[model samples]
Target: MTTMAATRRMGRQSWRIFSMQARRCSVAHDHTSSSDPKLTNFGYREVPENEKSKLVGNVFTNVARSYDLMNDLMSMGLHRLWKDRLVSKLHPFPGMQHLDVAGGTGDVAFRVLHAIHKAEHRAVGKLGGKSEAKNETRVHVCDINPNMLEVGKQRAHKLGLENVEDLVWMEGDAEALSLEDNSMDGYTIAFGIRNVTHIDRALKEAHRVLRRGGRFLCLELSHVSIPGFQQVYDAYSFAVIPAMGELVSGDRASYQYLVESIRKFPSQEKFAAMIADAGFQEVQYENLVGGVVAIHSGLKL
Candidate 1:
């Protein structure tokens, strides 16, 4: 079937599922409660707002070793393209300091440094100067997963990125960062924010740590807007992905939950509104690869 046809079919199925769920809920509860209904945001897991971090930590711990490989397999290397696009937009300059939250494996930080080096070289070329490149840019990678951070640090060391010394890895929570307010020039989170339970709290934390005029960048899986693509994507995500995980990482359940979480995340417009609500200004988003992923940029005023 065409992509449009697949999308229409999925829409009908979704409506049917919703109707069935509503009927079940109505039958279970004839009377309304004054208290709020228990909610499971994404991944179909029941969790309190306060417990999301721990739950997410468990997920990272389970998949840290296979995380990078799975990313390559699942996105067919398109994630690297997305990251490269994010780096291009970042336009990192020399001496700029960055904080990468939930930046497990340091991919974003490494890319930021690469961008800075490129910018420095470009400036040198303009000056008609012959100067040895110096690594002075700084970035900190903060995550709740120590093992993931360790893997990133080891990779950095292997690359002889001595500036990796400047890349501090801290076991930290995104919702409650320990960094000082208005201290960072840039902030980034890749495929990490959705795992956060209290996304608003994390956004607030990002705003607090960012200086005035600082940029906040997030790259994540997003709801695909194209017709017919959803069915193909859903089939791959639900069936092929878990099988790949089992074959590659020996973990199917974690990948299953990961896919479910992506489906459960808020739509692009809803997420942009949340960013604006968290005190960010001039929020904008760019859809990549037909909206399979998106990069959202916001500025702190």
Candidate 2:
């Protein structure tokens, strides 16, 4: 085909796929709203509250192998810096107990451990003595999807952290964490809350599990409201991201839902309010990349 003709054909194909997904999303929303009061969004589509988790699980499972690569591609490797900022805000300390929820790729958890290790070393350097015992320090990585947990475990093994007792991996739901109250010094979740069926419940659970003065931090994709930039961002999100997903991971539908879910998520201001309502004090948020992402934090007191 001629270059112009091929370009036109590809554009047509992309639009067709986008339209089909939109129709399905609309139908799902209509059906659920009319028939079931207990429904939550799976991207733009509505599904039973209980079923959203399984649907989200399927998406992660399908893209698990390519998750990190796709993140690099979609964000142009900025995700690494974003995660670093999240951990830095966490201010990990030696002999601290931390929980990283929905961090199935071990990204945030690894950073937390690295920060704690550095803190321990710094203490030793300051005192001119051996590092204090960190046997009580632990970083727990919790996620509901077993496949994602397995991926985290495999990555931990490859990084030689499999034998580290301070790093623990568990399969558990964020809304109902299987942890005792006042058990954690810090909590974090990255790029994962948009898929949650009940974000409020998860926030409450974070509060419930944290000790007084513990911090909760969340990094997530959010809305972009800059006038000219919003248009460009929307075009990129609706067009380029799904195309990249199709070419790289052979799963355009999942990426479509992923971006759509970002839109469905609460705004930074509203979410910060939700955290406060969940009994957190000093709730605040910082927007990054013109609000393409945000980090929300709160302290339990």
Model 2 Cα lDDT, one tens digit per residue, 108-206: 999999999999999989999976666888999999888888889999999999999999999999999999999999999998877887777888899
lDDT of 1: 0.76
The candidate maximizing lDDT is: 2
Model 1, range 1-301, lDDT digits (tens) per residue? 4743443233210111345334323322321231434443447665654566667778788889988998987776667888999888877887777888888798998999888878888878887884344455678889888989988988888888755555677889898998999999899999998888667778999999999999999998877756556556676677777898989999888888887777666667778877998899999999876677889999998
Report every candidate's CA lDDT: 0.76, 0.83
| Clashes in predicted model 1 | 2
lDDT of 2: 0.83
Tell me how far the alpha carbon of residue 271 in candidate 2 is from the true structure, in angstroms, after superposition. Answer: 0.7
Model 2: lDDT of residue 98? 96
Candidate 1, poorest ten consecutive residues by summed lDDT: 8-17
lDDT (C-alpha) at residue 130 in model 1: 48
